[model samples]
Target: MTENEPALDSLTALDSKAPPRRAAVIINPAKSGGPALQGAIFRLCETQGWAEPLWLETTVEDPGTGQARQALEAGVDVVIAAGGDGTVRCVAEVLAGTGTPMGLVPLGTGNLLARNLGVDITDPVSACYDAFNGSDQAIDVVKARLNHSDKEQVFLVMAGLGYDAAIMADTVDVLKDRMGWLAYVEAGIRKLPGKPVKAQISVDGGEPVRRRIRSVMIGNCGRIMGGVEIFPDARIDDGVLDLLVLAPRGRLGWLGVVAGIFGRNKNETESVEYFQGKSAEITLEHEQEFQLDGDHLGTGTHLAVTVEPDSLKIRMSI
Candidate 1:
């Protein structure tokens, strides 16, 4: 079957005897469209016969993970994550391996995952319709354990250490909102002068590979915002992660790397290295800043990341 072919067996497995009448929407009110969007969601759910639609708002401090956990605990048939990539990642982390399907309602600056899944970022009503009628698809999730002496935490989607993370940490919130995806380019230019850090990385069962790198990105799915395929071959449902290493030698080399990334010729760039692996371990020379799904997570010395194959069920437009 083709990639777009709907799995008849999976659709038949869905309980069609009765339409799903209960749903929980975990929304980030701070995101764009706020109350108006939430109201629309309520209307959409009601239209779908979801009389008891539970609405949960994400707090500025707690994010959506806690809310998603609550939604799952409430036994809702579908859990809709209404926010950006960070919110989606948090909800996916909780819903993974639980046989609970996740629905996306993109409402952030960069809806990377939504674009990857062929989701309609605009038209919340249409998006919700797809959520209600779409078949379930199993997708891969990247689980990262950031070891900072005593503390550890898991990450989903994309994880970055060094240059990319530094750019994320430094990017001003106002600029991000105003400039959208262009903010990353401005931040990247500002971060180009920093010295590369030496690190030891082990891919799958391979021997430790040591190199001086400007940045390292581990991606479960290909592409960033604006359809830029960072890891062109990366698949969300595949049981592997794409590891991208950048070690530009000079200003011209860095531009070349950027060109390659945008041109979908990552392997052609001399300053960049790409690999696919089930797991990876990175031991930095010193503590380095990192970001998980665009959210900065301070500094860490040791990072261990693995791909959880088909761990999350997502409602996709067939």
Candidate 2:
């Protein structure tokens, strides 16, 4: 037996009469850890006397939704998203409300969903064990409609528009490959000087709140890069979406925005405004960069986002 691959002989022996359980791994092959993660998951399944997993590699044209659908069609026990937040989002887009629990291996640069789920980001063996042995915890999924498109996409962690999305769109791919999440810092610094766009935001179909905003971030869970808590009180199963509208006032207004985010009271600053509701509709004066779970999805003049609580069953130790 390989090191760290638990000895599950007793359990397997006891369940010998039962049908073998299997998993479907929807992975992004572009991720560097793809082969290693697959090997680890395979070893764990063998150790646990489970059937070999059905491996599906994501492509540039189809990230993960098609593969996840294929996994569902195969009737696997769980669908594992073995890549970054984008892959997680794609798998989630297909698994939500289907009652098929999803697992995570966190192989991408920004493993935001895995981080929030407290998965073992640094160890493939441990993450693979969790995928096969962990408990189910239902979480919220945010559905976003860009430019009022009938086709909706789901994000598990967070989504952003304007400056934050600009950073995602502008980050150097080579730098990101070498520097990881820190590449965002460099891109953010360069995009900090852009003009704020006029936005009309309506929360839960209430009165529209009009303002010029540098960026607007919507969150389902709190933590982000470097363990920063962007939405302090946000919960994955809260059934509500947390919105942060950033409008830095002057040359040094970003400092206030940082303070408001990290300070004791995030709601008490003019540079940052916080809102919570079931849904939000944001209309911008013009098309701006938009992103879902750190993957830039071109530009949009309008976005309608709503929270679907306890819609996604994520298998992870709580």
Candidate 3:
């Protein structure tokens, strides 16, 4: 077989001396600059003497799960997610537990995971280089199992309900494409006027704590857009999950909460509450929009979430 064969995904280099590195790129074609990015990736592979990466373009329906699985089955040395958080999350879900390091090539808006890793988001070429020649790190992942459908998902950054999820759900696609992350601010402003959501949440087998909240975000990592610190204590490898509860009552309270998070004092106000846990069971008084990472899932009243620490291996800058 040729040296570039897909079967080279096994860690043969570790067993012996260093071997050729084979990578796979799972891309979402609808993202901006898709064609240019693909060309750049191929050229880099040729110039760097790396194996020709397995290229998989994702459709809106498939995202990256199917393509990522295919790459894994073919034994790709590393899987690169080349889109936004949704695409990254999909690829990470498939790569988890395989011990195959997943790489990040940020190509979409709100590159939350990439931002948390300090991956170069502005320069695709530099980002690709980092992904290809990076060190491996083990991070935690959240396993969210829906109560109504038994549907399971993996969230890499944060899973949120109420106001945060409403913002994601209400974000206009065209506006988001035009204004990028700023569109979320616009949506958040519009959503702030709405009534708060009521939910009962129990953490790590504790008693249910019911509250009327503006937003309840459970984070695997604390970084969010606009440089806000959603949960200051949350770390990707900490073996624990951090929760942010914003119970702001009105515009002034909302301003206070925003100031708290934006100023690095997210837990300093009564309107904002924080908790850490290994698992969370949340039941909403009424069906409300929810999001994992940033993708808004349909309205649901029940959410069961568990964190598995050191479960996924990811690539970071060397």
Per-candidate Cα RMSD to the true structure, in Å, reads 8.2, 6.9, 5.7
lDDT of candidate 3 over 214-287, digit per residue (tens): 78889999889977777777799988988888888777887778666766665788688888999998888888
Q: Taking the tens digit of each residue's C-alpha lDDT, what string does model 2 give over 3-114?
A: 8776799668877877789999988888887776778788889999889999999999999999999999999999999888899999999999999999988888889998
- For this target, which candidate reaches the highest TM-score against the unseen true structure? 2
Higher-ranked by lDDT: 1 or 3: 3
After the best TM-score superposition of candidate 2, give how far the Cα of residue 67 lies from its true spot, in angstroms.
0.5
lDDT of each: 0.82, 0.91, 0.87
* lDDT of model 2, residue 100: 96
Q: If scored against the real structure, what TM-score would every candidate get?
A: 0.89, 0.93, 0.91
* Higher-TM-score candidate of 2 and 3: 2
